[model samples]
Target: MGLLVNDLSVHGQFADLGSFAEAIERLMVIRQISLRFGRTLHCHRSLAHARVTATMTMPQAIQALAFEKRRAFMLWLTQHGPFWEDSRKHGPDDWIECNGSIVTDSAVGEAAWCCLNGIKQSLVSLTPSSWEFSPVPVDWVSNTGDKKSTGVVNHWTPAAIEAALQAEPAPLISWSQLDALAIARCTRLTFAADAFAPLNGLPFVSGAAQRLLFVLETLNRFKSCFDVAGQRTPEGHEIYHDFFTGKKEEGGRGALFSDSSDEEKSKFRSEMTFQHPADNTMSLFCSWHGKVQTPQLRVHFSWPIRADEPVYVVYVGPKITKQ
Candidate 1:
């Protein structure tokens, strides 16, 4: 059984004030990861919107995946974590300390506040008696009217999130008991856009972009596959359906598609597809006090199939010895 947030909070009651403070300290890890996620998501979406007619390169897809992976972490934090408002009302100097160092960055502080707000917001979607956050409506599609859109929906209205906070509903997870689950795992997943070659472009767009769009569209098709309803289909058979059929313009089948040259098609199957398992790995990394660390405890973006690795990979860190 999972440790309920309420119980975890109560556990703090048995410890000294120092431990209580220490418990809150670890929350920085969660907060930092959420901030990165939000920033990346915001940046990528903005870029993709601007480059609407252009082909999405591997670099763009990697960044987009990075953003999504981060957003998911933020969702996890808000849906499951304990947060307390900072008592300090003044400048950065008046702040909490973890491991004898003062926490001063506005970035970290801003992320903490956003995370707390997210937690309050989540209660709006839950039934009072239910311990878990409410599941998203599977069939709920946005009214944006774009046929290929599968962007996330805003489930809780602002007023509802506010009401839940005002009532002081139970938290998703209390201080001191946050898991290394997905968060920790995401920190270790390696992401490199340059790992792939520049897949050839089609006359219309590029064969690369088409394949990428195909995977993105199909990823959400089986979202409800593992639901409470225990309907059984053939093993690995779910990969094929409306998304893959030649009838759909987006599907890769017999559409007016054939990116590879006739000469190329006869020689090699140039493009490939990727599928990630349910419990795949996705990790993010950073450095603290000059040592490399996976502070946020999250996994790498789930790896795409062989045919569509990201286009460009960006590396940020201090110099290190090559092994």
Candidate 2:
């Protein structure tokens, strides 16, 4: 995901130069968190030249900072390459229809541009008196004259960005992309180094990767609950059943699944068993699975028994059965 620093958000009064510099520190913290989740931060190409206060441009304000602070800020700017030039190529001027209302606020225009361009905005609010750049909901008209809400240009404060780090990830279009990104993209879950290899030979289905992600997320929630309250909760299978049945909502999402029967598990124990990556100990009889049918796909995983451990995925491929 890309987080664009709203240049408009910085064009306001601050209590002091210190306060403005503090906001820059907050922005840097936000950048660190964003980078942890494989997200990039961006600023408009014109932001460096834009006036942050009545008399100071963004570069001027940075220059006014103490020597060490100025050097650090300059280093960060060079590394992140904040300035983005493609935003103007999208014809941002035509995004918001006038509808007989003259819309002249550059901030609102930029917000509309972000909305149309599928970019998230980060505000540089320095003080309590700073103006809130609220989300702008725009109606987009299709060539057929159908009007539809094209989503709002929502901006995140530093706190909001941190809060959203664990939210459900956006779906990917291919299994290869999902396999490459599953661990980083799914913040709450972990994967075995060999887990994705089996999936490489399998054919891709339209929504199989997304369904697999949902299942993984649900399992992550189950593991989290078990870690916090393992003694009081039911066994792993029972809790897993509740999650898939929608009976439990503590990070649960209803999806399709069933535990392998005792006969099947006994017959295919070797097939179901896998070497644990961390300890190289065998994780036996990973019978719990989430299934996607028609083409028939299955994700086989084991629940964590220890505290602070993640739900471990062992296999993702065609459903294994005794032929």
Each prediction's Cα lDDT score?
Answer: 0.24, 0.57
lDDT of 1 by residue, 109-228 (tens): 222222211211111211111222332111211123212211112112334333333454232231111222212322322334321222212122111222232232233232223333
Runs of candidate 1 with Cα error greater than 4 angstroms are 1-133, 140-195, 199-233, 249-323
lDDT minimum window of 10 residues, candidate 2: 246-255
TM-score per prediction, in order, is: 0.20, 0.44
What lDDT does candidate 1 reach at residue 75? 49
- Report the C-alpha displacement of residue 10, candidate 1, in angstroms: 36
Model 2's number of clashes is 0
Per-residue alpha-carbon lDDT of candidate 2 for residues 1-323, written as tens digits (9 for 90 to 100): 34556555566566566777777777778777777776656655555566666777777788767788678666655544655544332233333442333222343344444343233333333333333544444553333343434433334457777676657365355677877766765565556787777777666643456556655655655565553555525655665554454311221222355677788888888898888756675554578887654346677877533555556777877788636
